[model samples]
Target chain A: MTPHLTARNAFIAALVLALFLVPVYAVWIGNNFVLSLFTRIVILAIAATSLNLIMGYGGMVSFGHAAYLGTGGYAVGILAFEGVTSGFVQWPLALVVSGAIAFVIGILSLRTRGVYFIMITLAFAQMIYYVAVSLNRYGADDGLTIYRRSQFGGLINLSNKTVFYYLCLVILMGSIYLVWRIVNSRFGMVIQGSRSNDRRMRAIGFPTFRYRLACFVIAGMICGLAGVLLANHTDFISPAMMHWTRSGDLIVMVVLGGMGSLFGPTIGAVALLVLEEALPYVISVAGRVVTGHDVATAKEYWQLILGPMLLLVVLFARGGIDGLLASLRRG
Target chain B: MLLFIEQCLNGLQLGLLLFLLAAGLTLIFGIMDFVNLAHGSLYMIGAYFAATFAAMTDSFVLGALLALIATFLVGVVVEMVALRRLYGRDHLDHVLATFGLILFSNEMVRLVWGPEGRNLALPSWLNTAIEIFPGVYYPTYRFAIIVVALAVAGFLYVIVMRTRIGMLIRAGASNREMIGALGINIKLLYTLVFGIGAALAGLAGLMQTPILTASIGMGENILILAFVVIIIGGIGSIRGAFIASIFVGLIDTVGRAFMPDLLKLFLSQAAASTAGPALSSMLIYLLMAVILVLRPEGLFPAAGNR
Candidate 1:
C-alpha cells in the first residue's frame, strides 16, 4: 500500500468514526453541552465548506461570505415572524432568497477581477448588513428570537438537542460528499482551471465568468442552508451574523483547516470553534501558572494569543491543519 | 435651506477624512501592490494614542502631535515586521496577513485600554459655533476640520506633484522594476510610504475622535467608506479618491438625513422608517456598482496602473 493513500484513508476513516460517535459518546457521558457544541460546529463547518468551494477550489476570494448566512437566517426569522413556521416552506423560501441575492451579487460583482472583486463583494454585503440593521420589524440590529422552532410535520424535532445534533452531522457529511463530487467533476475541472489561469481557460474556449458566477451562486445557496441551520440551532438570528468581520471568520475557518481539501473546512470549523470554546480555560490556567496572580481577565485576552496564531499560520502554515495532515501521510 | 447647507458642510468634513485615508491607501496599493486591511487598525491606534496623550499632557495640540508621531512609528514597525514579507505575494496573502494584524491590534488595544470608547475633549475656542454666512452658524471645530483637511490636501498635492520624492513615488507606482534597477533603496521607500499612510490614517482618526469618539471597530466602518471612495474614484488614483470621497460623503450624509423624510412623503411612515437608513446606505454602493458597470476602471484611472 502507498503510505500516502493508506495514511489519508486512515485519517478519513478516523474522522468519520469520530463524527459518527460524538453524539453517542455525549449521551453516554450525559454531556448535552458537548452535543450542542458539536452541532454548532457542524453548522459552521457547512458554511466554511461552502466558502471553500469558491475560495479554495475556484480561487474566488469573496470577502463577504457571511451575507448568505444573514440572508438565510433572516429568511427563516422573517417567515417565522410572519407566522409561517413550516420547515418545508421556510427552508425553501430561505434557499430561494439566498440564491436570488447571490445571483444579483454575482452578476454585478463578476465584472471585475482581482482586488476589485473582493471590495465589491464586501460593499454588497455591507449594503445587506445595513438593510438588516434597518429592519425594525424583524428586530433590527438586536436580531429576532425564533420562539417556535420549525415544525417538521412530526418527522423530526429540532428541540431535542441530540436529534438536531445528528441531523447537522448527517447534513455536514452530505455537504462534504457533494463538494467532493463537484471538485472531481467536469464542472469542477472548469472551475479549477479558471482559478489557475482565467485567461488560459478563456483561450481554451471556456466562458470563465459564467462558470465562476455559477460557482458563486452554488456556494451562496449552500451557505444559505447553513444559515437556516444556524438560526434553528441558536433559536436566534441577528444582523451581526452577516457582519464583514464574521465573513472574515468564515474565510479564516476555510484557510485554517486546509484550503482546497474536501474535509478542510469542516476540520477548520471544529478547530476554530473548539479553540474559541477552550481558549478561555487555557488562558486562565496558563495565566495562573505563569503569572501566579488572579487571572480572570486572562480569558478576555485569549484573542491576543489567537491573533498571532492566525498570523503564524498564514506565514508558515499556508497548508493549514489539513496540509500538516497530508504531509504526515507522505512522510 | 439651512439644514441643506449644514448637511453639505457635514458631507465635506466626512469627505475630507475619507480623502486623507484614501490617498494613503491608493499610494500604497499603487506603489507596493499590497493590500493592507490593518490600515484601519492604524487609525484606531491613532485615536487611542491621541486620547491617552491628550489626557496625560492636559493639552490637546501636544497630544495630537505626539499621537501622530507614535502612530507613524507603529506603522513603520508593523510594515517592517509583518507587511514586508507580504510584498510581491498574491493579494490574498496581503489581505489575510493584514487581517491577522487587525485581530492582533484590536485585541491588544482592548488589553491595554479597557473596552470603553474614549472621547477627546475639544478646546472651548474650537467648540463654539461661528456664523460663516449671515445667520448660518456652524461648530468651529467642524469648520476647523474642513480647513485643516484642505490645508493638508494642498500640502500633499505640493509634495506629491513638486518634490523629488514625489517623482520617485510616481515613478515607482508606474514602473517599479526600472526604479529597482536604478539602485534606489526600495525597502526604505516602502517603509516611508507605509509610514505616511499610517500617519494620514492616524490624523483622520485623531481629528475625528472629538466628534465620533475613539471606539473599537470604528476604523472598520469608515475604512469601508474609504474603500468605496477609492473604488469610485479609481483604484491607485489620488485624484480619483479625492473626487469620490467628497461625492460619497455628500451622498451618504444627505441621503441619510433626508431619504427617510423624503420616503415618508411618498410612502407610509412605517415603511419609510425601515427603508430609509437601508436605502440611504445602499446609495453609495449603488453608485459604486453603477460606476463599475459603466467605467470599470473607475472615473479616474491612475496613470501608474496603465
Candidate 2:
C-alpha cells in the first residue's frame, strides 16, 4: 500500500488500540475518572456518528438531533420509573419512540429548505425539551436518577464499569461500521445526490424526500440508542440532554472530526470531549506560568478559546480533523 | 375581565420586544443572507452593558443610552472582525461560526460579570401602577414598554417605507447583486445593517432587563421566539414581523396564563396541572409548525424576494 493510505490506516489502528486500552490504563493508574470520561466520549461518539449520517452525508442539518437523545433517555428513565427495567423492553421502546418522533418532525420540517429547515428542527427539539421538562413524575427539570441501570438479565452486566465501557465501545464501533455501509449504499447515494441537487435527483426519477426521510429516521434511531447508553452510563437523564446547545456540540463534533467520513464523528467526539476535559488544566497551567498565581477561573474560560478555534476551523479547515489528516497524508 | 385585559397588555409588551429582536434578525438574514446564531449574544451583551452602566451612572436613562451605543459598536466591530469574512459562505458555516460565538460570548460574560445574574432595577417613577381602565391597573414600566416598542415599530415602518436608506435596504433585500451593480457600497451597507440589528436587539434586551434581569443565557430562549416571529412573519418583510410578533406574543403570554384552566376542562386535574406548563410553552412552536405547513414562505414574503 502507498504511504498515504498506510499513514491514515496506522492512525485509525492506533486510535482503536488506545480506546480499547483506556480502561486498563485507568485501572493501572487507579483513576476511575478516566474510565468514566472515556465512557461518556464513546457514548457521545455514537451520537455524533448518527448526526453525521444525516448532516455530513444526507445534507440534513438538524439542529434538533439532541431531541432523540432526550427521547431515548426519557424512554428509559420513564419506563424504569414505572418499574419496567428490562433492557429488552426499554431499549426497543427508546429506538421506536425516537424514530417515531423523528418521522413526525421530519415530515413537517423537510418541507422547508436552508435556514428554515435548521430553525424548524431546532423548534421541534425545543418542543421535546419542554415536554421533558414538564414530566413532573419523572423528575422534570432536575432530571431523574436511575437507581438501577437497565437490567440486561445476564446478557450483559451494565453496572460493572469495565463491562459497560466495553459495551459502549463495541456499540460505537458497530455504529461507525453501520454508517460506513449505509453511506456507501444506494440509499446514501440518493441522499447525497439530493443534498447536492435535489431538483436534479427528482428529475432523474428518485423520490429524494422519502430517501432523506428514511435516512433521518435511521440517524434518529441510532442516536436514540446512544441516549440509552448515556442514561445508563450516568445513571440519570434530564431535559438538559436535549438542549439546543448539546445539539450544537454534536454538530461541532461532526465538523471538528470531519464530516462525511466514516470515523470522523468518533474522532471528533474524542477530540472535542478531550479538549473539553483538558483545556482547563492547560489554561490554568499556562496562566500560572504567565502570572505567578493560579487562575481559579481559567477552567471556565476554556470555551472562550474553543469558540474562536471553531471559527478558525470554519474559516480555514472546512474539512475538519479527518480532512486535516488526509492532507498530511497527501503532502 | 380586568385580569384578561392586563394579560393582553402584557402580551402586547412581549410582542413588541419580540419585534425588535426579530426585525434585526430578519434584516440581517434577508439582506445579507447570514445566519447569526450569536445575535442572542448581542442581546445578552446589551443587557449586561445596561446593567453595568445603570449601576455605574445611577441613572437608568443615561445607562440605556450608553448601552445602546456600545452594543451597536460591538455589532459593527463583530461584523468587521469576523462576520464580514463569512458572507456568501454556506448557511451551515454561518450557523457553526455563530454557534461558536454564542459559546465564546457566554464564557466571556461569565468571566467578566462573574457567574451570578445582574438585576436592572427600574426607576421609581416607572415602577408604579397606572389605571388604564376604571379599577384596572397595570405596572407603569410594562405600559411604558408597550408604548416605546410601538413607537419604535412606527419608526421602523417609516424608515423601511419612506426613507432613502430604507429604499436601499429594501432593494438590497430583494436583489443584493443588482444594487451592488448600481454602485452601492454593499459592504458598508451590510455593516450598518448589522449594527442596526445589534442596536435593536440591545434595545429589546435593555427594555427587558428591568423585568427579567440581565442574566447569562437569557438571550437564547427569547432568541428562538424571535426566530419564530421571523419565520411566521416572512423573511425580509417588516410588516409580517410586526403582525406575527404580536400574534406569537399574545399566544405565548395568554396561553401560559390560561392554558391550565383550558386543559382542566378536558383533562383531569392532575393531568392538566402537569401538562399545562408544557403545552403553554409549546403553543408558539405549534403555531409555527402549522404556519410552516400552510405557508412555507411565511405570511408576508418580501416582494421580488424568496
Candidate 3:
C-alpha cells in the first residue's frame, strides 16, 4: 500500500504475484507457451539465487556454478535411463551429489583466492564436464532425452503442464525465501561480512574458510534443485547444460538482477529470458513496420545487440534493473 | 621410447605456444592489475586474422606478419577505448567489462567470418618434418614455433630486465603509484605494455593455427589453459607464467596422449578407457591444486619490485 516501499520489496511482491498469476493467465489465454517460458524463468531464477548466495553474500566469485545444474539434470536423466523415475528419490540424490561435489571442490579451491580461486573452480567444473561427456552410457555429449516427466506416485503429475508450472513456482519462491532468511540470519551476516573483508573476518576469529565452504555447498544444493526442475521442464539432460557459458549466463543473471539482494536473481532471470525471447521478434517487427523490409535474416544477430546492451549496463548501471528502479524511486 | 620422445617434443611445442599466450597475460595483469578475460579474444582474433591474411596473400609468413600487426593495432585500440576506464576500478569491474568484450568480439567474429571453422594450411616448406635426431623427425612448423617462442622469451627477458622501458615495466609491476609519482607517462606505458601482451597472444594464435584447427571457440579451451598456467605460475609474474605454461602444456599434452596406457597398467581396460581421458585432462588442475597447497604464491614471484 505504501509508495515508499523499497524497490527490492516491491520486486519481491511482484515476483510472487507474477508466479501465481502467470500460469493461470496462461491457461485462460490458452497459450501454455507462456507457462513454459515463465517456468524456465523460475527454474533459472532458482539457479541464479544459488549463485548470488555464494557470490553476493559469501564473496566467492565462482565461475563454475552451472556444474550443479548439469549435475542435477544428469542425475535425473541418468536415473531415468536406468529406469528409476521417482522424483522423491532422484531429486534428493541430485542435491546430495551436487552438495558433496561443491564441498570437495570448495575445500580445494578455497585454499587460493582471487584469480586462482576462479581458475580452480573453472578447472573442477571442466573436469566434471569431461566426465559427463565421457559417460557414453548416459548419452555423453549428445545428451539424454526424458521420455516421461518424473513420477510422483500420482500425488503430483509433472507431465500436467499446470501442475509442473506450479511445482516450479513453489520451489522458486521457496528458494528466494530461503535466501532471504539466510542473508538476514547470523550466518548470513557472517557471510556478508566475510565478502566485505575476508582477512578482517579471519582476524576477528571467524573460520572464514568453513563458512564460505558451507555457503558454497548450500548454493550448489540449491542450484541442483534448479537442475532437477530444469530437467523436469525440458525432459532433457545434456553435458551442454553445464557448459562454462551457462555459468557465465548465471553470473550475468546475478549481476543484471543486482547482486547481493534477495529478489534480484528472479528479476534478472525474468528480464534476461524475456529479452532473449522477445528481442528478435521485436526487432523484426520494427524493421517491417518502419522500413517495409523483411529483416528476418538479421534476427540471427540478436546476440550482437545483447553484447552491447550488457556492455552498456556494466558501464552505466552497476546495480542492474532493480537497482535502477530503486534509485529512481528514491529520486 | 621413440614415441615418448615425439610426444615430449609435441608437448614442448604446445608448451611454447601456451607460453606466448601466458606471457602477455601475466605481464598485463602484473603491471596493470587488470584481469582481461578478453585476452583470449585477442588469441581468437589472431587466428582469424592469420586465416584471412594467409588466404588473401597465399604466403604464410606474410599472412602471419600482417596478422601480428593487425592484432597489435586492435590491442592498442581496445586498450585506449575500453580498458583505460577500468584502470582505477575494482577487479570485478574489469572482469565484467572484459567479459562484455568477449561476447562482443565473439559475435563480431561470427559476423565477419561465418561460424564454420577455417583451415589455414601450413606452407609446404614449413609443413615437412625435420630430422632433429636419427630417429626423431618433428614437424618443422612446430620446431619454428618453439624457436620463435624461445626468441620472444629471451627478448622479453632483456626488455624487462635490462632496458629502461623494461625497468619502468618492472617498476610499474612492483608499484604503479611509485612509478607514476616518478613523473613517468604511465598511460603511454600501459598502452605499450598492453599492446605487447596482445601481440604475444596473437603471435601464439597465428603460429599455432596451422597445427591446431582454427575455429570459433578454439580460444575458449586454450583460454582456460592459459588461466591454469597463470594460476600455477602466479598472476602478474611472466617468469611464473612461462614456466607454468610449459608445465601445464607438458602435463596436458602428454597426459592426454599416454594416460590411458599408463592407467591400463593398474586398472581394467574398460575402467582405464573410461577414466583415462577425463583424468588426463584434469592433470593440470591437479598440478595447480597441489601448487596452491605448497606455494600460495607462484614458483617464481615476479622480481619482487610489487
**Fraction of native A-B contacts kept, per candidate:** 0.61, 0.77, 0.46
Model 3: per-residue Cα lDDT over A1-331, one tens digit each: 3445776577768778978899789978999789899989989999999999998777788989999999999889999999999988899999999999999889888887776667678777877887888787778889999987778896988898888888888888789889889988888888999888988999999998898889899999999999998998999999999998888888889989898877788889999999999988887888788889897766676777887687777888989877887787679
Residue by residue across A233-320, what tens digits does model 2's lDDT show?
9889999999999999999999999998888898999999999999999999999999999888787799999999999999999999
Candidate 3 C-alpha lDDT tens digits along B1-306: 888888888888888888888888888888888888888889989999999999999999999999999999999999998788778776666767777788788878888998887778988998899999997888898888889999999999999999999999999999999989999999999999999989988898888788776777677778888888888888888888888988888888899999999999999999999888778877887888788779767687676422
User: All models: lDDT?
Assistant: 0.90, 0.93, 0.86
Which scores better on lDDT, 1 or 3? 1
Better of 1 and 2 by TM-score: 2
Tens-place lDDT per residue, model 1, B228-264, is: 8888999888889999999999999999999999999
What C-alpha lDDT does candidate 1 achieve relative to the native structure? Answer: 0.90
Most accurate candidate by DockQ: 2
Q: Candidate 3 lDDT (Cα, whole model)?
A: 0.86
True contacts kept of 3: 0.46
* Model 3 iRMS: 1.6
Docking model 2 quality class:
high
2 or 3, greater by DockQ: 2
Which structure is stronger by DockQ: 1 or 3? 1
Off by over 4 Å in 1: A1-5
Q: Score the docking of each candidate (DockQ).
A: 0.74, 0.83, 0.59
Best by TM-score: 2
Please state the error at residue B58 of candidate 2 in Å: 1.9
Candidate 3 residue B105 Cα shift, in angstroms, is 0.9
- Model 2 misplacement above 4 A: A1-4
